[model samples]
Target: MDLSFDCIVAGSGHAGSCAALSAIDAGCKRVLVIEKGPPEWVGGNGYFTAGAHRTVHGGLQDLLPIVRNATAEVASTTDMDPYSAEEFTADIMRLGNNQSDPTIVRAVVDGSRDAIGWLAERVHIPFIFSFHRQAYLVNGRHKFWGGMVLSVEDGGKGLIAAHQQALEKAGVTVWYDTPAVELKLDHGHISGVVVIRNGERLQLSAPAVVLACGGFESSVDLRAKYLGSDWERAKVRGTPYNTGDGLSLAHSIGGQLAGDFAHCHSTCWDANAPADRGDRVLSNQFTKSGYPLGLMLNTQGRRFVDEGQDFRNYTYAKFGREILRQPGGYAFQVWDARASGWLRMEEYGDDVVDKVSAASVTELAEKLQAKGLEDADAFIETVAAYNRTVTAFDEEHPSVKWDPAVKDGLSTQSTRESLKLPKSNWALPLDKPPFLAVKVACGITFTFGGLAIDPDTAAVISEKTGQAIPGLFCAGELVGGVFYGNYPGGSGLTAGAVFGRKAGRGAARVMRS
Candidate 1:
């Protein structure tokens, strides 16, 4: 059967929901949103995100000034204090290494504030300001909620429910468990989407189609192809349904991909560990123990990348690149009691500390003996040195330059003060008994690369000539390079609102014309 809609949005994640709602609100007579999985399962990398929503204008206008102001405010709240738009742009450019699309970057940054504000106005959704609350502390109950659409339940369920309510209110039709199998193109323009529902193919025509179906974190072949062998071989900890459906369909329609080489949250929890109980962990846990968070070391026990370096300055991809140079493509985080104590302080609510302490460092080494670094003594020495260096650093550099956007600085400072440690102690020495060590392997949550799009209109762009792909739009993970290298505080959800609205409104306009 032939069906038509003013706009068609694939995926019901944050981005898809926002886009559909925006389009219908913009006066589209008919809008249809298709999800490959059930709404309850409409989760990808976004579910695991820290929920940072950075905007400049505070939901005033879709422009760059608002983004700069919002960034400044977020920085101020985090104690970094008063960053400029130019600085924010510089950070983005430096982070992305100048490979991002300038136009898209400008649009995303400029429109951030308004997008966040728009989401905050929703009656059912509650938006929390992350920076206003001080940095994330180890055991402190810190929940990040800025410009995010959260439900009353305070989990993925809440976010999905909020979006569903908004979409329904705006007169948008949602098709759950309906996977878009193909894109229909006519005369070099996207005309419709072919969806698979209950084993039957249904062709739904639209004037324009928006692909917000997220990335391929769960797809091994796509991960291997776009990311690296490590990602290809590693286990996934993000959404299961994010099988690169949008990428495949877009590629079939001649859409070009960008940032295919990027992925985020390089370190993940060891699902294989019996104690882990199939939960994910980050490599930064090593840093919590006063060891190098993402430093590089060889099988023979050596230092790489100044183990004391900050995680914000580098991406997980960089860490993965470093770890791959070591023997067996794996590394260990070594630390004694003092280091474990500090880690325990920081990881207050998290279960990492408990798991690390359940067994001795020697026993832990034996557990990961097959992974490499079988010498427990060498690991112990490494922990000792790490503790000494951390203690020394605390004495020398009393002031910690904690970036609030990523973590809770106030809690960190409070923890340090309570311990009677010097203010500059960036490193907490690991000195206590029963030293702990754990083998860490890289894991990816989502691919950073996908169809290139115009930030202003959320329209896909061709890589060959840098022109907008007519009648096609995209948002969320499908839009590459929007986050540059380091993801800003809340850009994921903000992008869903900003670009989702733009794509929806743009598609509706096209339908009317």
Candidate 2:
């Protein structure tokens, strides 16, 4: 069999799929994608995502032509606000504490819409309006919030299926159970790669290799080393194949390590989920991101972080880290009957999670005590104090209607009985029973640290020479400095596509040169 190829991409995930297609688009005839997992394990972390994509657009009308889920009747009832390039950029910079690399941020933000467009047109991704996740019906109209509105029809599984169809159509060959173990460097330039296939190591010759495998989030040792001791206990939220293979292959060849090594994108996941792998059928369903509509309490039954600190898109990524720091590496989300209805059924459906509920706060505390709540009395007192603050605020602003579609400032801080750590938005009195709660643990999505790359070309940057390595390119979670402490909800998929396209084109150009 012929092993000769112009460009060989590592990892058969969304980023690698985009890179393979883009390489073909850039006039490269022979391209190969190497997959680390068996034939069953494809799409890497992308297979476990919600398929949300955040891009700049002129609200609903601009997106109507691209999405299949929107109809005349749905558009009439939908109220979507325009999201601008500036707003997207500010979100990353602000969430990253202004420490994110400007060039990387600009590349992902500016290229998002076009990358998504390419995925839709060339890859035939079935785009949808994401009404279930991003919008809530207020009065009559479905109002969109958090600046993310586009997704695929059936989430990540659909995304990967579409990519597989496109790859077959494009004549891009994919080798399953083949993991790129090392980058072959000749005279300070990447020559090809050495990979393990079917229990044997083989060397493949190619001028260009695109590394889009993933980060070190799945490695228990690496998680303890970089993200801290508490993080070692965090649950893996994606493919178990992403064990920092791409990052290792690049860094072994002097690739610069940048971004927040101590930080990552995590969220409140179901406490009962598997420790090291995600459920293939359930996918991203274990993600408990409904805290923005309720409250989070530690084992002591006290509020830790402000649940309404920002939009769930902006805050959910880092909130998992907060949960890890809690006692026993878990927390409980408290919600009343009113706000519980607002939580997505995909995540909080009766069959999806094992939730504990009671008719009163006292009874709820008693139920939670069996689930490992140390101080049931403290939990009861906490709820009482929070209710008092919300009641006080509601009395002062009686005309204010509680709307979940926006940051309806029904705050607890404005009241005289406000707790020190206030629920700054969507502060509703948890008076109505039955009160409900779900046990959650930190679910790590990906690490924030990895190989640095040139923003323009997606070529991996050398630490020694401060220049792009001749034949080495990377995208997806392997390209560091695009995110820091946290990230916006839908931006990860968009970033992967943006840099994937650049990496593929760069690899093709490297071969041609």
Candidate 3:
């Protein structure tokens, strides 16, 4: 097979696939995708995702086309509020504590809707409302309030397969089990790449190269070195292949690292999940994020963080670090029957394990004890105190109002007298029958830090020279300066698609020149 190409995309995740598609769409005939893993793991971390894609849109009208199965009755009742570019930009910047690059954030925000539309219309990828993650039923109507309203038809793996099929149909070649080892520089510009395939090292020359591989989340050495001392203990949430090859290659050629290297997109994952990538059958089901509706207790049966401080999208990323800091690098999410109903169905599939349930809180505590928890009395007392001190409510002001976005329910009104951390909202008395608990541990999704890139062209920028390398481009988790302490849910895929398209076009333009 010919190794030479006009453009080479490292990795075959959402970003790399989009980059390859855009390059071919831009008339670059020779486009090849070099994937480090085999075909089963071709999607990288993107394959494990729920396929949520955040984008700016003008309410339900703008959403109708992409949500292909919307019935007339559903369309009439479902409410999808307008999410503007300004709102998207503000949310990203504010969540990053103003640490994100304004220009890159602006570009991503402005192009998100177009990116989604392009994938749906041009690439023939189907989209639908994200019923599991973003929608809520209220007063006989379903309201989708978060900017994350749409996702590809069959979640992340399906989405990746769909795009890969589309690219293959267009005659783009994807080399599996081939990893790019080094960037070959020609006169200070990236001219080619050195790759390892089947025990042989081959140098593939391309006029332009796009690095959409991933970050260092899967590398224990890199995680401990950059993310903190104990970060090596965090569970890996996706594919083990994202060991920061692109970032290291870029750094060797003077690319500046951007964002806080110590921060990552972490979450509350199942304690019994595999140390590396989770099971493909369960996919993202290893996550247990319904903490807002219940209590997260440390080993000693004490609430550590306020469960209802914000929406799950705003708080889930950073909470895994806290969970890791607890004793034994784990915790338990306890909920009653009411909250159990609200638990995502994905988390309770046939493949799930490590859940404990009982008819009473005391019995639940005993069941938890058998699962290695120490004290049942302490847990009983904690629930008793929580229920006793919960804020009073009457028929007029109910405990929960079913708001789709933000904290919209009863909270422990003044834990002012208690030393324990309080539940800020959606704090119902855990007195219902059939109490349940799930063991949880820290799962590191992706590292937030990576190589900085030029906003306009997605070109890799040199920290030393403050100039973009002529033929290098990047997207996906390899591009930094977009996130810091936290990330809004569904934005990662959107950012990937947006910048991937830009990087593809930029590389194609370079190759054409």
Candidate 4:
């Protein structure tokens, strides 16, 4: 086989796959994909997601084909609000504290819907509404809020499989278990890539190379160096192979480092979850969100953060860092039967290692005490105080238009509840029987720090020269300046697809030139 190619893509995640597919579609004579991970775990961080993608759509009418089981009955009862490109961009920028690169943010927002539609139409990837995560039942109707409503049928794992099939159908060759060791730059121009496969080192020449090998989230040393000292102990939420290879590779050639190094995408995961990569079978099952419906207590049994500050999609990523700040680097999500019903089904699954249930608050406190809770009595008192200060639940009131999807926060009886830290939304008194608690720890998803790229062409930009490095492109989490302090769920995948496709086309054009 010829070892030379027009374009080479590193990594086999959603970004790399899309890069390869677009290159092949763009009429590249030979496009090669180098994946360091084993074939079974080739999708990088995207393999563990629920496959949610934030995109602009014209309400239910525009989503009917993409969302599975979109019958008239379901459409009438479900509120799939229109999401505009402006709204999507605003959400990302607002959540990132307006620090995100506007050009990249605009690119992501503009291409998001088109990317999803392309996957549905060209790649034959089936999508469905993430009813469980983005929907709430209000007055016998299911209302969907947030810009993220569409998801792949079988989550991230399935999305990877679909991409693999699409790549195969497109005649793209993927070299699995092959890690790119070095980039061969000739006269500061595009040249070739050095890779090792099965203990054999080989150099393959390519006019252009696209780096989509993900972030340094899985590297303990890198985490401590960039994310903070406490991040070394945080659980990795995705593939362990995603060290700093992509960042290092790009940096070695004068690529600019950008974005918030101290911040990352994180969540509250099970305390006993593997310190390395999460379980593929359970996937994101260990994540324990929905704290707005209940309360999160530290080892000392105190509410440190406002549980109902905002929707879980907006707050889940940053809250994991808060859990790490606790005494034991963990916390517990406590809920009663009433609130339990509103919790995501995964919280009640068997994969949760530290789940405990009790018929009464005292009994629940005893169970928590057994698990090393510092003060069981204080926990009970905290719950009592919360209950006394909470607004009365009256969803059936004739004068009330209580819709969680549209409501600002959880309703209070008269908006005059007195408390130190109040539950801003979805506050219900924990007066029901069969109380439950799940012990949780911090799970770091992906690092926000990465290589800077040209916003329009997805070309890697050199900090030293302040110009694009010829024949080098980038996409996925490895491309920085997109996220900062926080992230809106489902935007990562969209950005990956958007930028990945652009990188492929750009690389192909470079090769042709």
Name the best candidate (by lDDT). 2
* Pairs with backbone N, CA or C atoms under 3 Å apart (clashes), candidate 4: 410-425, 410-426
lDDT comparison, 2 vs 4, better candidate = 2
lDDT of 2 by residue, 261-364 (tens): 98999999999999999999988999999998889999999999999888899999999999999999999999999889888999999999999999998999
Candidate 4 residue lDDT tens string, 1-513: 588999999989999988999898887978899999888788888888888899988988888977776688888888778999889888889999999999888889889888998888877777888888889988888888767898887788879889989988888889989999898899998798999988999999998999999999999999999878888899999999899898888888888998888899999998888999978988878788878778999988798888887778888989999999998898889999987877777656654556799999889989888787998888899888788766443333335433456545554344345567777777777889999898889999998888888888889999899899999999999989999899999999999999898999998898888
Alpha carbon lDDT of each predicted model:
0.58, 0.91, 0.85, 0.86
Per-model TM against the reference: 0.76, 0.99, 0.96, 0.96
Of 1 and 4, which scores higher on lDDT?
4
lDDT of 3 by residue, 1-513 (tens): 677899999989999989999998887999989999888888988889888888899988888977766888888988788999888988888889999889889888988989999989877777888766777777778877546788777788778878878998989898999999999989988889999999999999998999999999999999989988788889999999999999889889898888778799999999989997767777788888889878988877777889888778778889998999887788889989977887787875446856788999999888887666776788888888888656343133553554535467566655244335667777777899988898899999998899888888899999899999888999999889889888888899988998899999998899879
Predicted structure with the largest TM-score when compared to the true one = 2
Judged by whole-model lDDT over C-alpha atoms, candidate 3 comes out at 0.85
Please write out the lDDT profile of model 1 over residues 1-513, one tens digit for every residue. 438888899888788887887787778878888877676565445554444455553222233222223454343333223334554455566666787667767777777656655765652454443322223433343322222212223334455666777777877787888989888888877789888888888888887998998888777777667666655555454556788898888777677887635555344234232221113233222222223322233455554544444333333334544554456555666555544443333232245543343245456555545556556566555544554555544455556443323431211123223222212223444445565655554555556777877777888886566888788999887888665444443445666767888898888777877
Model 3 residue 194 lDDT score:
95
What does each candidate score in C-alpha RMSD? 7.3, 1.0, 1.9, 2.1
Candidate 4 Cα outliers beyond 4 Å, as residue runs: 351-353, 391-403, 411-417
Least lDDT summed over 10 consecutive residues: which range in candidate 4?
393-402
Q: On a 0 to 100 scale, what is the lDDT of residue 492 in model 2?
A: 90
Off-target runs (Cα >4 Å) in candidate 3 are: 391-406, 415-420
Q: Report the Cα lDDT for residue 323, model 2.
A: 93
